[model samples]
Target: MKDKRDFRLEIASIESAGDYVRDILKQYKCTDRDMVRAQLFTEETMVYWTETANEGDILQINVRKRFKTISLSLSYRGAQSNPLAISDEEEDETEFSFIGQNILIGLSTVTYSYENGYNVITFTLKEKGTNPVILIIFALAAAIICGLIVNRFAPSLGPGLSASILIPLSKAFFGLLNAIVIPFLFLSVIASIFNMENIAQMKRIFRILFSWFLGLTAMSAVIAVLAGMIYFPLQNGASTGVNEVNIWTQIAKMLFDIIPSNIFQSFLDGNTLQTIFLAVITGITMLVYKGRFPVISKVVSESNLIFSTMLDAICSLMPWVIFICIFDMLLSGDGRVLLSSIAVVVLICICFLLIVLLCLLSVALIEKQNPLQYIKTIGPVLLIALSTASSSATFAPHSMIASNKQGIRDYLANFSIPVGALFAKPFVVPVLLLMTLFVGNFYSLTFTAADVVSMVLLCVILSVAVPPVQGMGIFLFTIIFKRFTIPLEGLAMAASLFMLFDYLMTTGNVFSINISMLHTEQRLREKDKRVIVYNNQKC
Candidate 1:
């Protein structure tokens, strides 16, 4: 592995590591400022890793320079310990506390992983143009201008063209995302379950994320329920046709729906919740009955590779899809009213995002790293989520940022993100809750405690189950409105209106998962004392 992009170091000593790193940065044309940071992070990391390694273990550094980001992926063997992932409380006593303070957990995004027999630690830095701040600014401005023109001057023309052409194109893009996302979710979740080094790691991370999941969902439900309690719009035109279903029957049906008699039917029907349930059962059974089904794991892993490659191809088209969606959305006559009506939803979602960010900062502080770096890593991804409002569209950016910037292990981030994108939803809950409330208020409907409980539970379950792509939110809202006897007239407006707010919800989720990954790594480091490093000869 000796290319301009890859370095294979057979030497044991760490003395030349600094010079090697500086030369690599220079070769990659990284800015002088980035060069300085990369060099410092690299030298300190090498020193720390080298000291942790057993005698005579080989060290390798792979350099990847992509536009405005450069990553140094170091792989070594002989120790399984991840000292680089130590907590702030444990930072003081280490021999390389300065290195830990200055490099591994410094200005760079340092992520650690143990693959095979080697510890692969990646130190990454923004090389300029890594953040999509400028792109987002330009996109927003362009969308606003284009939207206004299409709505005012060529209103009929825009809507007609959008309905006939742009909307379909966007739907096709969504279809493409749908095609890959389900398989990606199925395979990635199963793979993570199979590949987890520690069950407790997954449990702890799940507890935190699930708590946020429930809490956010509760927030949405509480707001909707409260709004329903006090707010009533003109009900002169309220529908008398909507009927509430039997709560007990619905609950039994929902439980029954989780498991399908024919697993293939779940896919054909696009029953994502059922598919996930099946995948979980399959994952657990396979994990318990290992070796009897080795080939299944291999097949799933290979399929995962194929789907991931497809995901990359589809992500390239996200910008165009976004353009079409915005064009279509802005052209609609209801766009203005929809936007105005959902201001509260958007405001509350932003507040939740702030809380998420605050929590991330706290975690970063405890981990003894700069929280801004976390923001930087996910900034580009967040912008994509904001613009596209599709988690599948944000996959590439999120994976890259989480891997490079947050230093989350490719294994953990890769597994966690796709699975999280579907099952780990934080945004849909609030949006759906708000929409349900809007419908009730707009129709002057009354809600009982049972209605609130059911709606809250539905928000949580559906948020996890529904794939947050185009129209999925609307689809779920329709189901809720019907189930709770809320008028369905406002579904169209509420759904269309929350497109902007969907951005915040998704951006918050992207941030939340990275936080989960970071927590997992820190906890793993805490429990595992042996920071193993190995040479190529044995592995």
Candidate 2:
């Protein structure tokens, strides 16, 4: 069918806009939820325009479907006006009149511009349930099929095609990821610190919770190193990359090297350790002197928003990157190497499961609660985490379970869940360690004692420092693999496997957060009991 639909309606008859949107969305067989959202968006914009424009003014609407993206554009040729403008100076504009504007904004990608003397507003929405992970998997399968076909029929063309197209595109993808990681990391850390509410008031709980996060991550790192050594030892061809320098000296240098003499140089060099240090210092300075320098905070906030949106756009390219990378690997005869890494994937999954179970049991026994019952209570949260692969997406249901079923204090649960959603990463530590080791051994790059120490330290720091956002899995993989001086092929391999690991990693993170909250609640209760007993004795 037709990909484009358009309509011109009088401002007074704007109510019909909803019907127009409904008809177009239904043509694509969009879900009812999407239909309703489009209709609501149409109605809201129409109402706002109806109020702002003359009675007889005409509003032109265009709806276009491009693959999975459904874009709607509203244009009017009168004096410029933005229907989505929230703070326009109008006598009729009330706070209540703008109630649903933010919701509409959140529901879709909204843009406004003045082009060709017409004020245009556009809303772009994606079809629901289009899981990027599944898309990447399908792309991988398609690439394998196509690569095999090409390899059998036209063997001579494989090398040229890979060298010319796939290799350049693969480099471009990593280049984009590499360029964005440092700034994204810098802004995200600052934003996360600034986002926390009442840090002074919640310092006690924050310290306790932060300790739990670190403890879990450190434990995961230890497990990964030990397990990696057991399951996948260095082969005969592997080189340990050990230098003549003393291991202790290397450790000392790494520890002191985090403080950058020139911050700009640190940024230029893409030094994450120094970047993280700078971020912490800047975040705390902004937080302390927040009232004195409001403009810097505003700039930081706006910059974070811009970078976050750009990062999402980059992440959407992942499926394409996966297809090309896999296709290139097959053409280059590295398919066998990739196939051998299945054991590594399986091992990572098992380690995550074991960690989750261990945390659950430890928290249950310490709090005197039944482990089975705890699992049953948080099962829905885990299911959402597994399906969505987003810790924030599971926040609402997890909060409900924590407060109502688990008997966690409401305020504590609310505070802890948001903090956990952002900072708690139970799976990243182990996954990073294990994958790096596997790749190291694959490349015959041996890790000396100092190398292991440095890698583990870096893993634990990055796990908590990086915000859990879309595309962060790929970003983290790039950072960890690159830091270890592992080759680009290792990074590519890890990036390809991230689609499968993300779901399990997210679930593990959710599971660990739930347990940390339980422990936090228990500690608070015990502290209160002690205070009460001491006060009674004094009286």
Query: In terms of TM-score, which candidate is strongest?
Result: 2
The C-alpha local distance difference test score for the whole of candidate 1 amounts to 0.57
Deviation (Å) of 395 in candidate 1: 21
Off by over 4 Å in 2: 1-129, 234-247
How far residue 47's Cα lies from its native spot in candidate 2, in Å, is 24
Clashes of 1: 14
lDDT of 2 at 97: 28
Candidate lDDT scores, in order, read 0.57, 0.73
Tell me how candidate 2 scores on lDDT.
0.73
1-539 per-residue lDDT for model 2 (tens digits): 23444445445465577777787777776656456656666777777766566655677778777666567778777777666544424422242224323332332245566668787777665555467777877888988898898889988999999999998888887888889888988988887666442445456677887788777877788777677767865333234334444557877888899999998998899888889899999988887785477578667866776676677788788888878887888898877766788888888878887787788678667987788888888999999888867665665678789889988877666567656766678688777777788777877777665567677788888888877666777788787777777766566567667767888888888888888888888888899999999999999
* Clashes in predicted model 2: 2
Which candidate number has the best lDDT? 2
